[model samples]
Target: MGQFYCLHCDRYFANSTVRDEHFKTKRHKKRMKQMSGPAPHTQLDAELAAGMVGKARAPDCRGTLGAVEGLPFIFLLM
Candidate 1:
């Protein structure tokens, strides 16, 4: 006898037969539908979009600030 785990429902079944039956349940179907959709944005994402968060600096190449062969030497140092 082995246990079967359902990730969506967070429940365990005695066997694959029971687990397969659980997958056909309305609760499991609803959970699947909810998980299939795109995730909602969080407050941090909203702040970043609104420019409230500090903006990231753009890569500076232009053969300046120790750029070797068009690639930043700082990256190689890392």
Candidate 2:
């Protein structure tokens, strides 16, 4: 396993020296900036998810789910 890890970048670094260099990279900076924004869940999204409470409103599976770029995994209750 790597000694240093960057959560936003989802990468591991062998050492602090390499990790510091990675942190200063434009790619890492761009990724960090992108990850620091607000979530996409709007009122409509909340309303849709809330439907899980009632089986009548629930879809055959989960109601239409959304996929955003860059997210490795996400689970929304619905």
Best by lDDT: 2
Q: What are the Cα lDDT values of the candidates? A: 0.65, 0.71
- Best-matching candidate per TM-score: 2
TM-scores of the models, in the order given:
0.52, 0.57
lDDT (tens digit, per residue) of candidate 2 on 1-78? 997999989999999999999999999999999989877665545665565334465433243443332333456699
Query: Measured by C-alpha RMSD in angstroms, how accurate is candidate 1?
Result: 12.7
Displacement of residue 70 (Cα, Å) in model 2 is 29
User: Compared with the true structure, what per-residue lDDT tens digits does model 1 show for residues 28-54?
Assistant: 999988888866755554554465654
Distance (Å) between predicted and true CA of 36, model 1? 0.5
The superposed Cα distance between candidate 2 and the true structure at residue 47, in angstroms, equals 6.6
